[model samples]
Target chain A: MKAAEKRRITRMTSAGRVELDDAVAVEKKVRVAVNGEEVMSLYCSPERVRELIVGLFMTEGIIEGRWCIDEMTVEYGDEILVDIPADGKVSLDRGTLISGCLGGVTFSSSAGGGPAAAGEVRIGAERLRALFAEFQRTPGLYELTGCIHNAAVSDDERIIAHAEDIGRHNAVDKVIGRCLIEGITLEDKIMHVSGRLSSEMASKCARWKIPVLVSRAAPTSLAIDIAERSGITMIGFMRPSRFNVYTHAYRIL
Target chain B: MKAAEKRRITRMTSAGRVELDDAVAVEKKVRVAVNGEEVMSLYCSPERVRELIVGLFMTEGIIEGRWCIDEMTVEYGDEILVDIPADGKVSLDRGTLISGCLGGVTFSSSAGGGPAAAGEVRIGAERLRALFAEFQRTPGLYELTGCIHNAAVSDDERIIAHAEDIGRHNAVDKVIGRCLIEGITLEDKIMHVSGRLSSEMASKCARWKIPVLVSRAAPTSLAIDIAERSGITMIGFMRPSRFNVYTHAYRIL
Candidate 1:
């Protein structure tokens, strides 16, 4: 699926107005239905539909017993249509659990969604900086359209899996969902994202047991709290020259 | 209410790690209850709770008939609590309506949110450039933490009202909600925002019938589509010298 499309747009500067083709990130609504019951609409990049669904369902706890991604039918057009036939009884309270702006996901700080496995994987600050620079340089949709956010999973060696979406959370979900489907373990792996470490972003990493969370943007206060509680190593403002380690500094040797 | 707070963070560079105080954006969950029934938790900046609720309620169509923000009580702490005694019945389907990633607000293209009143509110390109530069110059929460998104409602002369929040949609809502409470006519105003013009951002401005929308970032494909459908003058990549007009070019004189 095409993640972006170029269209003629009028550009204006102090000199004058000129017409040129500009690429805009593609975002289409995918209406998801569970067992023929219309459930929700996911606004995201057109690519990675199955990965997005798998990630969303797994993280949102939609599958109770039995489900298969192959049973789902995805149709594309002005809008994408998806029907998932999970054999298990899906929980309907997910809408309430993950509600409101900035992809709000409320994880009870104490007992809820236990802390990520303790991270012992360590890498030098210089090596980590170069790895991140290389990870960012392997751009896909972001280079075409600056509006897209991307997330990637990596080991100490190199980048393994990555996904891009119009929504930052969706991108994280896609990458993590791909790993889940392909049977790749998220334990002791670093997850890198291209947006602020909001509460939901932090919670998603913690829920998936991603040991290290890094972002090019700043982190919110709640994000730091979640990181400290979840035992996840949170890093923000990851510039090439320097970075800030908010929690679990032992991860950086 | 302080929108930001300082915290100690470990900074890592090629040299080594050092501890320094960092100002992180403050985020607190404000549980909103309408008429004694708990509704939704809005994760946002602590300041401007009333404006956030007012903007959220009005834009989300929570108020059916009689409602006033003055009747709302907001208590602050680790988590902010709010109770609103709305005189009229509130719709409960708001959760289903504005659901999912990136503040999705579905607007039907056919008869949905009708096009914004044909915008004749024109501004010279140079004047608009100056106005936007000046608008962005007056910093609030962003200067403190750098994680907050801000939106402002401006007439041709100067900025009238502005708001800041952790969520981009919430910031837009606060400004619009403030105007709704203050009886500011939005039909002839321009909205300046600090993030990408996503579908929700475009829909919110279109829903409010704001004539011109300017941003210092790119617009998604769906955002441009919504802008064109709603007769909004969409300008993005709004740097000091250049910008791109995706729709309704006539609004730029």
Candidate 2:
């Protein structure tokens, strides 16, 4: 697959040593330039090229004015080249973060969509678990390479979108961008991931006001705080039949 | 421990439901400013505050001139405030990454070290596994929270320096910085990480001219390429008694 490549490796077990072919995840640099300004270069699995850029720009607020994916030009190969044709300038002076609030808790100024507004949507625990299980099963990247992270959007019923990347945050960005371009509304949606929930992960979900965020790993303290304040139903440490809810338990009935 | 905190969580198991106090990894925003420019703000477990900055600045080359830990000012609390009081400046135009090489296998322009040099260090399979096993057991943060990534610098005999963080890259940076400040030589040393071997991770070890990189996880394709080109012995998927060597097998007897 384009996302992974088989390589020869020597495995040494207690009994003996043998040469075998192992699937290694493929990661390449994707340099996204907005207008004429070179924004940033990040490495990720070479898939979901468009979604990754859009989601990154939207969440990081790297753009100045209204933008759309239609204005993006992508060239995929050894490296991914993306040029944003909109008035989106690289003008988010993130350097001013120095003057941010000093409470040990600082949210990115470019928080997407602000905190999630309360909705009447509620999901049962079993349904949430099943949805996450289905989300895990669909992503073939992790099983193949063992180092990939997957992210998906779902409702109480089924998954709506999914993407995989070498980086968990990049996976999240890919899914967010896919949903945005596909005209999929993120409201009252459950965002599931295959990695730990960090502060940045929690904030990404908050940016879209995602109602519930679930991961198959632990959540950091700042992640829990962001979920609590943003009204997100934060769930983590999700196993085959169990999970932990750290915030907005009301939404996880 | 300061790296982790106990928090109330609702657990939903297949057998039953209950509320429990679970240890969650602590993550706080640490905004780093060099000279007077707010370079960037990141989230990490609050420890090794100085090592992290030095390692980060040195590895990424975010600063221009010489800097010292003694010239740094830090305020620790709910969050961390770090001001680099050196002739150091945050003038690295990483945004110009747009004009980088088009090969999908582009390395970062600020790659700390060009590559690992050929070294005379040779470690047997058993010895390398034992060293990694020792490295893994020493990080209490992971056992407490299961989300922390630990990185350590070690010789064939013993682990010399170690650090842990919520982010794997941050952990690696902390260790690198720790070794730098402690004046530990990186030549012929092995850098062990408790996470996937990604391109950036491989490059980080290469930057320090570390001859060996071992991980208790799988490696990405680009990582293998970098390791091979840099002449580093890359080992991954390390179990208690089993491991895979992907590059420079000469270093593993």
Candidate 3:
């Protein structure tokens, strides 16, 4: 991962102002080509480009089972290009513009239609509060630029996988992708994000069948509907002591 | 515009918990079809669908002149479908997913390549601070739902147009669409938004040649780069007392 750039910028403060060098998050367009066709381009932080692409493919169901990528190469000169095995199964032309903060392309309509997960998990309120506290304290690019979103997958004890990106959806994808690549099971785990819980976010969680989706922000009406329909426990507006469980409250004891 | 819905929700406070009815923003997908082909779908507030589409076409550079749309129909049924004349030139298959929180599709690369604005416009620093104060205080759906993003076009005196949506980019498009549909010229106007400034947001403002963009949040590195290249004055962290001018400081007197 490349380090954030130190750029000289004018800073304004309450008492006065001064010129200073600030650590700004660097972003570039990474064109992901499956086989030979350019499927999509993402304007993202330069770090974790490979993980982002792998995660995108995994979540979109382009590469089922283990990694089907025959070869992967990252060309970092001038323009960044990631070439991966197209494998004849990845359809490049069927991409649709999904409604994510940062631009995203998906192969199918990410509707809530997957089979419901069969499991029961109980998370204590104090545990959630403690986890949220830890989540807030554990910061990186967000603290530097104040312009990134993060998604983390955690067990009852600690965070397992975390990823940050300029796009909330990408962060979620990175976390899921990291888990999948590392062979970590996602069922009955908790997914926490820093952005609002929109239907797209809900759809991503649903696709992974993560039982709990937590955020420190509000959820859209469609997100709530999706969570309820998908049987995922949706919690939002989380703080040190309280949170709102919109659906499947039985999972949060 | 449709009114926000007031729904009952469980609120957990630090002191205790209670059930309350909160005003929530309403969002629905409007499938925009240009010349009869379904190009893309927008998950937006249940209002201003036409302006949103028109603005999208205008920014995307699909219809060159001033509103080349011959006819438009909003089919308000179980599913919202917007039908507009394809004009024989609108290419539906060439859409690119944009990096917006709420997903956006661009017809072409939204590069900062256009005729530069003519003449000079200088906005006073105190006036900008005053305008930002007013901008923060003149809240609408944000006050109601706390989940919506807003983009407002304002002169030195007051806000001229404001649009809110689930996505920050959509709110900007809606604002631009409102301006174009109302025959308002965008030259030398200030675009203020509630979200962080990203390259895509800068691209949107640059496409319209809006002279200055002010945000209450931080800006990514690419946003600054685009703003500097396109001669769009970018300001971030705008408060009543201070702000940071990232580029084109000549515009701020």
Candidate 4:
């Protein structure tokens, strides 16, 4: 395997110039297959194919767990083919394919319901503020490439699983996938996203049964509504000292 | 009609404890329906629904020009309904309906033949560099929000249309939509984007027969390959004074 090379960029400012070098990210297209049929194609960094595939399957609701996947193959050049067992639930439709600029694929279903009902997970105002501070300090892939979104699953005091992607939804999917692969229970975890807390983000968290969702950015009204309905604690505009709890404020204090 | 009320937010910086007040953006969801069928929902600033609808339609290849749209209605809370005459070529699919986070949706089609054919318009390298300098100064939205992409279509010496959006692809679509509405010919226009020259971006330009596509960011190898086959001029890492023309350099100088 060839070692990945890093590029050093030099920028001249009004006063002086600065030089920074970071790892170069190469884009590769992976074709995910299930049961000998092509499912979707993803363009991503080549670092962790297994994790990505496993994560993609779980988060996309393709497979419930690793046991559902019979075998998988990662071909370097054009695509990564993943073959699963012949299950009755798996079927492909031309119309079901997500036709868009980012990684093009489709979920088996719309994955739409509402926010998941909040369960036993709880966090105080101080803990939430501290989590935001630690989240800001966490290393970001986007700071390196000026691209990528980060998603983390945390407890009251510490973060457990963190993933980054060019797409916000992808980052969440990766984290959920990691948790499933490692057999980590997501019921008590707080999900943190680098992007805004949109309805879709709230919906995804609901699907995973994660109780709390936090973001460094704003949240839409729909997101707040879903959070209210789902009983999840939705926090937004999180900072080191202050934050807005959109729903379930009673649990925050 | 009620006037759109803008909210202001105050924030304190770490340096000298400086306080700053900035305008808070209002987020609204606009559902777009083509011929009585709901196509997709977009979250955008409510200021430019007419332009956004037309631009989105043209860029998505839903309508070739303004003539195809018989009538369009911008309902306040519901969908932006557009009436188009029944044509055999136009078909609507609900399954593929996807929501854009902030930027609009970019639909990717399968890579069929090759790169798009280059147009008849040609310009000198010095003039192209000058245009890049002007393009850099035109991202007003980015100047305000620090988060947006700008797209412009220009001829040899002057810019014809410019649009900015949270998504780079949306900016391109807005420009294309504006061009269609104004009966501006894209044949002689060179496309400039404030984001990376990805394959999807290149594909959007190709679909419109826009020959030259320039960006201030890096290009993927697949984008270069497509540009080469399409006979389009692909320029990446574009600075005010310099640019790397990957394919079809003959038209650049």
Instruction: Judging by TM-score against the true structure, name the best candidate.
Output: 1
Candidate 2: CAPRI quality band: medium
lDDT, model 3: 0.73
DockQ for each model: 0.72, 0.65, 0.50, 0.14
Q: List the residue pairs that clash in candidate 4.
A: A31-A80, A100-B108, B115-B229, B115-B230, B116-B230
Clashes of each: 0, 6, 11, 5
Global CA lDDT of candidate 2, please? 0.80
Clashes of 3: 11
- Ten contiguous residues with the weakest lDDT in model 3 chain B: B97-106
Candidate 3 wrongly placed segments (more than 4 Å):
A1-3, A12-17, A62-70, A92-113, B1-3, B13-19, B63-70, B92-112
Model 2: chain A TM-score against the true structure? 0.89
Sort by TM-score, best first: 1, 2, 3, 4
Model 3 alpha-carbon miss at residue A82, Å: 1.1
Of 2 and 4, the candidate ahead on DockQ is 2
Clashing pairs in 2: A78-B104, A79-B104, A104-B78, A104-B79, A112-A207, B113-B207
Q: How are the candidates ranked when ordered by DockQ, highest leading?
A: 1, 2, 3, 4
Q: After superposing candidate 4 on the true structure, give the runs of residues whose Cα lies further than 4 Å from its correct spot.
A: A1-24, A39-42, A47-67, A70-74, A90-144, A216-253, B1-67, B72-76, B79-83, B90-149, B214-221, B228-253
Top candidate when judged by DockQ against the true structure = 1
Candidate 2 residues lying further than 4 Å off, grouped into runs, are A93-115, B93-115
Indicate the DockQ of the complex predicted as candidate 4: 0.14
TM-score of 3: 0.88
lDDT of each residue in B63-111, candidate 3, tens digit only: 4322243357887653579886543455432233222111122233232
Of the candidates numbered 2 and 4, which has the greater lDDT value?
2
* C-alpha lDDT of residue A144 in model 2: 83
